[model samples]
Target: MQRDYNLIDSNRQQQQSKRGEFLASAAAAIAAAAVAAAATAAVAAAAVAAAAAVAVAQQQQQQQQQQQQHQQQQHQQQQQQQHQQQQHQQQQQQQQQQQQQQQQQQQHQQQQQQHQQQQHQQQQQQQHQQQQQAAAAAATAATAAATPATAAAAAAATAAATAAAAAAAAPVNKASI
Candidate 1:
């Protein structure tokens, strides 16, 4: 009975040691699970920060693009205004050229009218002088024709009167004989 009691006491001591080892293993597993949960939360926070950075960068790029578009629109409007001003200047030059041409035409017409009037006056003076010369020549020809006929008739009448006077003087001299 003493040997049997010694064997039972040894077995009981061995079982108590196994139970203490199992309790220590359970505690270690819970500690490892808590550490893993903390590491996962840290990784999720890092991912959220990266997404916010990307969104900010995209918004800045959009703002820059809008500013560039507005500047281009202003440049196009200035170019259009310059083109319109150039067209207006060209139209004004064309109008000035047309006015100059009209003035030249009017001057040429006035010169032509003045030349025609001068020629008409010269022709009138020439016709009046010719008429005066023709009248003077006609009067000179009539005077020359009348003078020669009157001188010849007066010579014939004087010769017949002298012949009658000679015949009467010869009869009166017969009484003296």
Candidate 2:
């Protein structure tokens, strides 16, 4: 009976040793699983931070492009306004030149008309002087032709019809006396 009790006690000690070895291996596997989980979490956090940085860079690039487009549009508007102003100034200058030319032409025509009138007046004065001289000559000729002769000698000639008239007059001979 004592030998059977000793054998039972040895079996119990062996079972306890096997249980301690299995518990120790289980604890080691649990620790390895915890370390792997921690590594994976760190990798996920780094990926999230990189994504945020990329988003910020894209937003900044978009803002710069919008500002450039606005500035270009403003510059184009200013150029257009300046071109319009230059065109207006050129038109005004052309109009002024045209007006000046018209005025000069009108003045030239007026001067020509005045010169023609003066020539006509001079011609009329010359004709009037010639007519006056001709009238004076005609008056002088009429005064000379109006002189009268005496008729008293004719009355005596009636009595000379008789034969006594031959002795009263001495006539000039055809030949020399």
Candidate 3:
């Protein structure tokens, strides 16, 4: 009876030792799995941060490009407006010059007309003076021819002198002569 009791006690001790070793191994495996999960989560977070930074950089680049395009468009519009204004000014200048030329031409024509009128008036005056001189000469010749032959020669001479004085007073124009 003493030997059987010793063998049973030894078997119980061996089973308890084996159970403790299995539990220790299970705890070690759980710890390793937890560490690996934490490492994977950290890597995922870093990747997300990198993607967000890339998206922000792209947006900034696009905004800058848009701003540059807008500025270029404004510059082009200003140039076009200035070009239009210059064209308008040039057209106005051309019109003004044309008007001035027309006015000058009109004035020149008026002056020419006035000169012609003055020449016509001078010609008429010269013709009138010639007619008066011719009439006076005719009157003097008639008196000399119609006088009586028996009359005194002095009386005839006096009549001729009076006629000459009348002709001298009536002075013919050089143009008519």
Best candidate (score: TM-score) = 3
Query: Against the hidden reference, what TM-scores do the models get?
Result: 0.55, 0.57, 0.69
Query: Which candidate, 1 or 3, has the higher TM-score?
Result: 3
The RMSD (Cα, Å) of candidate 2 is 20.4
- How many clashing pairs in candidate 3? 0
Q: Write the per-residue lDDT of candidate 1 for residues 57-138, one digit (tens) a residue.
A: 9999999999999999999999999999999999999999999999999999999988886776566555544544444444
Misplaced by over 4 Å in model 3 are 1-22, 148-177
RMSD of 1: 22.6
Worst 10 residues of 3 by lDDT: 168-177
- Score candidate 2 by lDDT: 0.67
Q: lDDT tens string, model 3, 116-166?
A: 978876776767656556655665565566557634664555566566645
Off by over 4 Å in 2: 1-35, 126-177
Top candidate when judged by lDDT against the true structure? 3
Model 3 reaches what TM-score against the true structure? 0.69
- Output the lDDT of residue 138, model 1: 43
Q: Please, what are the lDDT tens digits per residue for candidate 2 over residues 122-143?
A: 6654554444444444444444
